[model samples]
Target: MMFDDLDATVKALFDDAAAPAELRAADISFDTPDRAYKPAQATVNLFLHEVCENRALRDEARVMTRSGDRYTSRLPALRVDCAYLATAWSAQAGGLKAAEEHRLLGLALRWLSRFPVVDERFLRGSLRTPPQPYPLSTTVAQTQEGRSNAEFWSALGVPPRPAFSVTVTMTVDPFDEADELAAARRLHLDSTVMPHAALAGRVLDHTLAPVQGAEVTVVETGARTASAMGGEFAVPGLAFGDYTLRVQPPGGPAEQLAVTYAADHQRLTVVLSQP
Candidate 1:
């Protein structure tokens, strides 16, 4: 599902008229074997250079690729130089998108193509470590599991934390107009609720406030997932699944629900009753 979203986004971006056209343009010179392979190698080199030149990469390279002639500081410089050369070659011959997609696909084929390699071993080992920590004031998630840990540690080239899924069960009543009204007012119920949030992609034992199984489907997402620690079951790293959310009590009739999401951090409420 994650890869699906990425693939869609990349395809959409490439389809746009303004995005680098050369990236999407077909290679007519494929008849020449040397010309055919040159593009792929050029792109791979470009991606490698970008990764190497990044400040974080420079630090890691210092530890990974150490030599008397090539000091740690030179790592970033070398990578940038190499990438620039490749980028120039691609731009002069292939155009922008070709150069861009070449790098994009070189580094992230899953996003371009929907087939991602799904191995527990690779997932566990895909943690990325940043060259430096976020600002002291920034909130860093403590759990090193699933995709977040994979993304975080992969940046640093560290192994991903183990993967775990958490389920949050809640119940609401469609008959209780008063409680529904109260919850709607207090929780600011909206369209942003995931169709069924409990079966989302990540762990969220942190942010959710408990409710006995009821009639309405409960949904939540965004920063709340990470911030829902301490008082509630805040879920993290949801993998995309429909949840059998408990609505209000068994005696009540189900009401129509329409969830809408306007922004990245919109909050939602679950109201079982209608006006």
Candidate 2:
């Protein structure tokens, strides 16, 4: 997407410079393969340079997923800036001439300066639909230092000439982690009045033996439990209320009892005679 915008904007700059027929006399091109071919017409070339993340426009470390579940992005986006070098060439029939080169270079600078910020209206392709972050700017346009221009031209096998070092920042998605659909889950919290105490009891037979398989059921809530070892029956998390405790022993008739429960109540043991 960035390359598309860069190409279109460069094309627009020349159109704004003058008519295409007139600008063609200068032979403006984004390609820079042949540096030895001295065209009869003056030439302007654009060369891509450095690309680094734009930390200034870095977003927060939080991101919202499409599903809208509770979460945050641990990684940040890759907001980057791309650099390009726009240079001019001479229009001499023999080889190269500094005089004609400077003229073309001046015009190049003038036309580019007219677009300190590539207007959104002039934007093309995806650069327009979901346009780049506001005015697709051209902030870092100047002469670069540290690296020798002579060495750069030597690598290109051409004499060094002044060129515009341009930089434009754009945001790119690091991943499509949000593209897939995800299931959303909700959390529910239940409030409690007072803490509940375990309701424990015991069941016995006429021979003073413990009832191991006795069923202890609450009539009010229909909550049930089986008698454990030593005929012990315990149920937890019951609220303070009156419950008709029913004990239905295996192969025996059921017995009922009216039980009132409250906070910090003491445990009780129920003895079942032969029924």
Candidate 3:
């Protein structure tokens, strides 16, 4: 799981020998710090308390990648914030336990606070080779706004302990590859511009077969064209107004219908009666 990788990454941050020997020797854990859980060794518990979308880093743009002859457009990766509650635990009793825990917690805070952005070397597992192209962002010892510490501890059935929040922002790409589009090899420019709107449609017979070579005309403008193969026809340079459309099938009777032509009135389907 991604969280498991994140846990490993966090643990890696404390694995350096340069840190205090006590801190390096302390065990790193990603477990629920509940009342029932008791550790026999000095442990730094990292409980993932919240997972949410980092709206502040939301990206609406799409990412485009071009292959040899095709290109794909995919939505940008989502930025997610994983917040962890970091606390220290020691097996010692009374004041010794509290002091050791505090010392470990302080050392952890010092180590974590140094990296606002996780170093690439410290990233572990899938995080080390993230699919998305965003760096892991970190926030240390910051006050998180969501669930209060008291409520969080209460939910875990444990008393509140001294702890700091560690938030790491990671990227998730959940969508499959977008449809690929073939590359355009050539461009055609049409210089003959129509001063007015155009109308287009297809001609079909009663049985829904294409009626090629049928004459179609706009009665008001006298614009006319013959339906080509596949029953497609177009009449350009027509004013925006009401007009009567007349369609005459080859060796067949003519049909007339009224239509209102506007810029958006682009298509019409003319179906002829069966012989």
Each prediction's whole-model lDDT (CA): 0.29, 0.69, 0.87
Candidate No. with top TM-score? 3
Deviation in angstroms for 159 in model 1? 20
Model 2 Cα RMSD, 1 decimal:
12.2
| lDDT per residue (tens digit) for residues 44-147 in model 1 | 11111111222322333322233443433222222111111111123334367455545544332222222222112221111112111211111111222443
Residue-level lDDT of model 3, residues 164-244, one tens digit each, is 999999988888869678888899873233345578778999999999999999888788999999998888877678889
* Model 1 spans with C-alpha error above 4 angstroms: 26-275
Predicted model with the maximum lDDT: 3
Ranking by TM-score: 3, 2, 1
lDDT per residue as tens, model 2, 1-275: 66867677666767663534445467766666356555555777777656887777877765655536544334455777777777777656444477667667776666667667876766777667665545677753565567655666788887677766766665566665543444457667632222446677678887778899899998888889999878977778687777789998999988888887766453666677655
RMSD of each: 28.6, 12.2, 5.3
Clashing pairs in model 3, backbone N/Cα/C closer than 3 A: none
Q: How many backbone clashes does candidate 3 have?
A: 0
What is the lDDT for 214 in model 1? 34
TM per prediction: 0.16, 0.54, 0.67
